[model samples]
Target: EHKGAIAEAGGVKALVDLIFKWSVGGDGVLERAAGALANLAADDKCSMEVAVVGGVHALVMLARNCKCEGVQEQAARALANLAAHGDSNNNNAAVGQEAGALEALVQLTRSPHEGVRQEAAGALWNLSFDDRNREAIASAGGVEALVALAHSCSNASPGLQERAAGALWGLSVSEANSIAIGREGGVAPLIALSRSDAEDVHETAAGALWNLAFNPGNALRIVEEGGVPALVHLCSSSISKMARFMAALALAYMFDGRMDEFALIGTSSESTSKSASLDGARRMALKHIEAFVLTFSDPQAFSAAAASSTPAALTQVTESARIQEAGHLRCSGAEIGRFIAMLRNSSSILKACAAFALLQFTIPGGRHALHHATLLHTAGAPRVLRAAAAAATAPLEAKIFARIVLRNLEHHQTEPAI
Candidate 1:
């Protein structure tokens, strides 16, 4: 009923003014006011209102200035709720950014009070959804702070590790931030979290590694930090679909251009060749390809699941297949058929991924694997590729790659019999 009264009385602005005015003098009044703002911000309509009236600034100030841990926690919660509201306006995130909320939130992440730390981490996780906010967090030294939080003892609350890893996952999206995270010695901690008993921590850590893998240099750093075996273990053992998905994504990134490294595993006679290590990673990846496909078959479903937990963009599906193809990983005819189906019915992203995977399968190194699968002739793959090449909405990279695949498929078909 109080919530309804607040909503009736000019909504979030009233709450913001009360918070600002009371926060200066009365601890009891400030806590109540911040708590009200947190509740109001949970409602999407009130979130935009809160941002418009400068409530985000008040919340950040309250969190920063409050001596009471409870007040700080509540203020952080309000900021997080506002950021998580997900209104198209993005005003909440913008206001928080302008108000210097990120720096305050980063400070809270280190608070001795566990509730304060958890709430601050959660708020940063929400704010990190904005690319600019991510850059700001990283620029403000949030990456090292977050990594320290995530590296806390195993007995620590799972929520702390989850939120810290999640924020790191967001920071890892930018190439420069990815390098910063590696430079801060974040890779080993993240890899360690992947082994946590808490599924959320495991999943979030995998996600951070996935994003970090986007930069080739970071990918190598991850590999050197023993990330490959850890990810492979998660892919094979985890019950959470998201965990397995992220594990596969991390592997894909780590091995993207290192196909020849894995290939060397089979032919090299030198006992000291890195092939032994590469071989284990390659076998694990090939073994889990079907699971990866199942996990990503419906991009929308996967995206929805991810957003429910961490509110980040989905991993590019094509990268997974491209890496597998680069390693000359073979697929069954049924799997090729699935790619054809995706080409026909999936979104442009998946279509491009499928087309490119088929393209790789036609290369000389990959051709022998497809001998048993008539994907080019019987499955109408060429028709799908040609259509994708001509589609208006297809990404230019997709279209060009599709055309190249079609041309190659045609050449393979028209060649004289030996």
Candidate 2:
């Protein structure tokens, strides 16, 4: 299947030929052909076949020249499906690299038809995973378009809300785009969307908010827009563990003692009635974050990591808490260094949060775990981790995570260099 048997089976060439021959007339032939390719593009194995058979050029032609909404939706869906296989193939960047492909998809986001808009946004979302495509989409006015979509989609289907917010989430991974999204009024709709009853909607919205929260201006904007309580709700109640985890991280970054300067909490003089409400919001965020981390801890497994000499025991403990998606989270060495510094910070909550972030980054088998472990090792983290583990005042979870980190370091560093 991965060999793209469709080409051998002759199906891919047939669909591509049909798409190339059909014009954008009233007939549904072109639409059906594009739609069939779209369906095939969703299969990882068949997707390459479609591409190899010149399907991308055919689909991009339809996306560009076709006036039919049906054809447009199918073409965009096919592009989205094609871009979805980035991990296994080059389709993500390949889609964007196609002539007029990125701009065409960006145009499709403004489609009057909701289906076209959703598929276009999803294609951009998937495309945004590629570094070049992420910046390219923004250059194509994607930030403003997506923010407007978020604003207008308030009453639209949950599917629309999810994609609109998701597209923003993908773009906001970059610092510049994160700020751009906030300045373009992206944060308000995301905060609204985060309160949705739809799990997919709020989960994606929470992700956008999480990235947006990394910037101080956006963090304060979130607070000004009443995003604190919304995030607090997701952190405490979301059925999706990833949603809860991200909401907690957003709050952590907000409360990591960085935003105290604003009059949001109180003026420099410190009002008798503090407005920041840091006491309750910070407490709630930390409580749930700690809870989220502990959910992965098995007392029995941790006992071995904590007491035994076997590296496998520690590896078990580390993997026990592994959130595969968290490994995809990229943090600079500066961020890792800051976490090391937080290990001995005055508050145990910050220490625990720091430990949690490091644990996520250092778990064995993660995409970036080895990179993170290397950073930790170079920072002379073992001594600091030993201190955190032995600190009399450290929270139990913090100490547990610190030990896990130490063990993880011991385990990964000793591996044979490839």
Worst 10 contiguous positions by lDDT, candidate 2: 267-276
* TM-score per candidate, chains pooled: 0.67, 0.89
Model 1, range 1-418, lDDT digits (tens) per residue? 5665677688667778888678667888888888888898887777777877888788888987888888999999998888885436585457456656788889988899998999898988888777788888887779888878877635678888888788888777666887888888888889988988789899889888877775666776777688888888887788776677667656754554433443443444753465566667656664564455444345553344334433132223333323332433334465566567656643444555455556556653353434523556777777777788778886554565565556556566666543
TM-score of 1: 0.67
CA shift of 410, model 2, Å = 2.9
**Candidate 2 ranges beyond 4 A from true positions:** 1-5, 24-27, 262-280, 294-320, 324-338, 378-380, 416-418
Stretches of candidate 1 exceeding 4 Å from the true structure = 1-5, 259-275, 290-418
lDDT of each: 0.70, 0.84
What's model 2's overall lDDT?
A: 0.84
Question: Residue 35 CA error for candidate 1 (Å)?
Answer: 1.4
Error of 1 at 155 (Å): 2.7
Best by TM-score: 2
Q: Which residue pairs clash within candidate 1? A: none
